[model samples]
Target: MHELAIADSIVQIADRHANGRRVTKVQLKVGHLRQVVPSALAFSFELVAQGTSVEGAELEMEEVPVTGSCRGCGVESRLKEFPLQCRACGSDDLRVLEGEELFVESLEMEEV
Candidate 1:
């Protein structure tokens, strides 16, 4: 699964920042549009981090809901998956105000 690669990447970045410190947890802000399966990502994280500095590190994910603004109705609302139409007016002319992100928010680390 691609989540394995993604988890590996996260471990690499965390390892660089941890600098010999043990990682306790990693927080990620994931958007709905990112389409990442949280369970798969967590499983992959545990598998890839085995015997590493981050072994047993917890993977915490915060889901960001899809919010979009429709030009036709001037209304902002949650977006349904795919087709990306506005919920208020059913218009395709929608601009996303949030969602579509995948980034590390924080890393819990031991103090030396």
Candidate 2:
């Protein structure tokens, strides 16, 4: 699954930032459009974390909803399904505001 790749990236980031410190927790911000499975990501994290400072580290994820701004009426809409359209103007011309992000927000670490 792609979660394995994502988890590997996360581990690499945490390890780089940890600077030889033991990672305690990783605060992750995942967007809805990423389509990432939490269970799979958690499992992958644990597996990728082995033999690293991030081993045994807790993974906390925050979900970000898909938000788009309609260019027709200049209105913002929270799109939940396909065929993303503006709620107010019913326009399909929209620009994404958020919900495509996947990044490590913060890392809690202890001195090794």
Candidate 3:
């Protein structure tokens, strides 16, 4: 699964930022469009984190709903369904405001 690669990257980032500190939590912002299966990602994270500071750390994911601003109608809305269209007007010219992001926001480290 691609989650393995994603988790590997996460561990690498966390380990790098942690600077040898023990990580207790890893906060993430995951967009709906990413289609990440939470369970799989968690499992993958655990597997990838073996022997690293991130091991046993909690993986907290915040699901970012798909939101966009319509260029035609100048309306901002949450796009629920794909063939992503503007809610105000039937326009495909949407500038995505949020969602479609996979970021490691922060990490909580153990006491030094």
Q: 1-112 in candidate 1: lDDT tens per residue?
A: 7788889998888878888989999999988888888999999999888878888999999999888899999899886478788877789898889898888899999887
Q: What is the TM-score of each candidate against the true structure?
A: 0.88, 0.93, 0.91
* lDDT at residue 20 of model 3 (Cα atoms): 90
So what's the TM-score on candidate 2?
A: 0.93
Model-by-model lDDT, in order? 0.88, 0.95, 0.92
Q: List candidate 1 stretches off by more than 4 Å.
A: none
- Winning model by TM-score: 2
Question: lDDT by residue for model 3 over 15-62, one digit each (tens)?
Answer: 999999999999999988888999999999999999998999999999
- In Å, residue 33's CA in model 3 sits off its true spot by 1.5
Model 2: per-residue Cα lDDT over 1-112, one tens digit each: 9999999999999999999899999999999899999999999999999999999999999999889999899999997787788999899999999999999999999865
Candidate 3, lDDT over the whole model: 0.92
Candidate 2, residue 69: how far the Cα is off, in Å = 0.5
TM-score of 3: 0.91
**Models sorted by TM-score, best on top:** 2, 3, 1
